[model samples]
Target: MSRTSGATTSPGAALAALAGAQFTVMLATSIVNVALPQIRAGVGLSDSGTTWVVNAYGLAFGALLLAGGRAADLLGRRTVLLAGLALFGVSSVAAGLASSSGILITARAVQGLGAAAIAPAALALVMDLFPPGPGRGRALGVWGAVSGAGGAAGVLLGGVLTQALSWPWIFYAVATGAFLVLAAAAAFVTTTPVRESGRFDVLGTATVTLALTALVWGLTTARRSGWTDPQVLGAFAAAAGMTAAFVLIERRHPNPLLPPRLFAAGRVTAGNVLMALLGSVWIALFFFLPLHQQQVLGSSPLLTGLGQLPLAAANMLGSTLAPRISRRIGATATVTGALLTEAAGLLWLSQISAHGSYLADILGPSILIGLGLSTAFVQLTALSVEGVARQDSGLAGGLVNTTRQVGGAIGLAVLATLAGTVTAHAATHQPHLEALTAGYRAAFGISAAVLAATALLAAALTRRGSTPTAGEPVPAGPASTAARAN
Candidate 1:
């Protein structure tokens, strides 16, 4: 075995490279939000039709995340990373130059597929390169910070590029970043052996991907078609059937995409649940916050991005303090406290009016929620991966990410539904501004409830400070206990 670790590199150089790649991936996902309006106008898209541009990418990326992670474990991480980057660059260029909305949407979906491959591979590489300890914790913190920062910076970058040049510039920018990361990855990453020898779970991948796609499509279509519509009902039914099939398939498969044993522990179950709920809330905020700033607050794109800076800054601060806090209070308590703080912030934010001031109404809540989410996310990631064997680390990492993406997709669909329903109901009784405010308030309220529930779950499920002792074989689950005793 190679004794060289990432720590041998210049202090923090490896972390910087990892964070740079993570930032670029996250930036690609978010920067498109600011350009949506321009793209809608340029391509003559209906309001409903335009949303597919974002959803297409999100769905593909979220659905394929597990398979991508498995690929990283089986193939070389470096190879997967490079392939993903190349695919992202090619798709971005296609999206930038497309003349029609259909072509652009297709290209965006391809870009999402690339993201699914790249994100897990990148995360797994980071974990493998940095040995598990305080060094790993710090690197994870930087990763979380970069993820948060990319989200914040997206609004600013998108606004500048869209206003100064065109919406296409967003894709161009992502392509440039992808190309740069590809070059850096090729130069910096050393080759590692494929650790897992099991056959790929092709059937499991297909069923789960289709199941999730059906679920998201059903939820999204429910907004326009009313849940009673045949299309919506059919999609839901298909999702249920496919999910059942996935369960059965996984039980018999020698190498399942998601091992059934991973969920045997209470901590793993709770972590995955909390991740889903918080993930949804986080994505919903990103989707709606910008809309609220531009549409309700009458802020320009650049001004809106700047106004949201408090949240990003607070998130970084929260992440930086989390490891220390965890050491003192334990992961469960720390995460619960953070979640409660976030819940309070979300509740306060739900009361915003069309005439609300940014500083008085938004900033305080934004900061609190940012702090809460940042702290909770780090702890959640730690809990999910703890006690897993070295070889299965990549799988654990992928599952954590998949849970988050799936949760975000669900949250976006549910919030969008609530917003649409509120707006329609209010429009029937009141003015346009009042209707929009009603929609925003309803969405925020629902998100607050979700966060509160997640907090409660985390408190009930996670135990205090359960870090594994050095060199002790990380137990897989209940079945592994018998094997260990032998």
Candidate 2:
């Protein structure tokens, strides 16, 4: 069932177009993670140098997200999306064919820039295409599900390609997916009128991007170089100075990249915080869990990938059911329940021992986390855009996604540092294997705490009420006020 131009397309078709692009972008981001060791070996990279491969992409993507959203609003979304896909595809091929670590890292940075362009544009497009009702709710629900499933699929795909073929095959596979999505988007997506009146906030964009990049890089480097290191301290100082400048710039600029008014509302502030915390927990799980399955459990790459299938399936089911459940219970309650469930699941997962069985110890907790993520994601998307005017929807959507990306990047860096610290401490008294497992446990415990914090934030912040039925507008609230004020 293909959607064609000028045909009355179903909500499912519209969602497929949006979700397919999201899935491809997410898959490209994560599929490289599991194959990092192989890539490092292949390209003869030192441990410090290897970390850059992932950080380069994340830093670029997170920093440019808001600017990308503004660009989508200025230019046509369809045009920007197609351009992003093409850039991503070309970069993927470049990374796959690279013979040196430097070349691959540079290509990955380019891919991040492409992803920054694609993600916010894709989300804004969804809000544009779907009306505010049950149809839009269902579409967003599927969108959330596809995103969770895509993360798991990336791990599986990475493992499969790295084991059966080579690490480069992962990039090759992503490139193929990007091309397919590009074709579908070109055929089905309709063009909208460009906004000639709105001006781009170049100063705001540069300041904010630089500030965030510096902050994240400093935090990440502090893990490896110690908190007292000159480079770490200097980076943090630079970040602080730049952030202050960004605030000043935004206040003065007529067209700001991130409008200060967005943070004035209590609910919007809370929602963004929750999104960031949830993102951090989710990214930590994907990064560390795979390591445990392979290194601690002594499983083959294929078996490790297979072990994650149940979680992926459960995530899909949760996303599919979230809309209906939210209608019955309310969005706030649904999100709260998801956060608690995720926290509990992570806590349970931290109890796994070296002698634990996969099905007995891992599968149950994995399923719980999957359900929690699916439910929270759906609610987050809904709440982020709720009550916003049509014109501000793009900015609202961009903020939600930007929070997630930045949170994920920050979380991964912190957790990696924690893991290293635990491992080093344990190694002073025990074997390497024992130390590694201990580190994994400590990391999971911290992740559980983060999820718990997010749950509390959600409970405190989210407003109580059912979403509007088909063809109805979202009720006015603090979140809506923030969007407009911005």
Candidate whose lDDT is highest: 2
Each prediction's RMSD over C-alphas, in Å, is 3.5, 3.9
lDDT: worst 10-residue window of model 2: 1-10
Q: Which digits, one per residue and each the tens of the lDDT, describe model 1 over residues 1-486? A: 221111124435555666777788778767877777788888877766666777778788889988887787677566777888899999999999988899998998899889887887777777766555666677677777888777777777887788788999989998998888888776677664444437789999999999999999999889988989999999999999999999999999998988766665326667777898888987778778778877788777677768768888998998888777876677778888988889899899999988887987799999998889888888787667665444455566678888888888888888988899999999998888778888988988988888888888777778534443211223456433422332
TM-scores, all candidates, are 0.93, 0.93
* TM-score (C-alpha, index-matched) for candidate 1: 0.93
* Error at 385, model 2, angstroms: 1.3
RMSD of 1: 3.5
Q: How many backbone clashes does candidate 1 have?
A: 0
Per-candidate Cα lDDT values, in order, are: 0.78, 0.79
Model 1 is weakest, by summed lDDT over 10 consecutive residues, at 1-10
The regions of model 1 sitting more than 4 angstroms off are 1-11, 264-266, 464-486
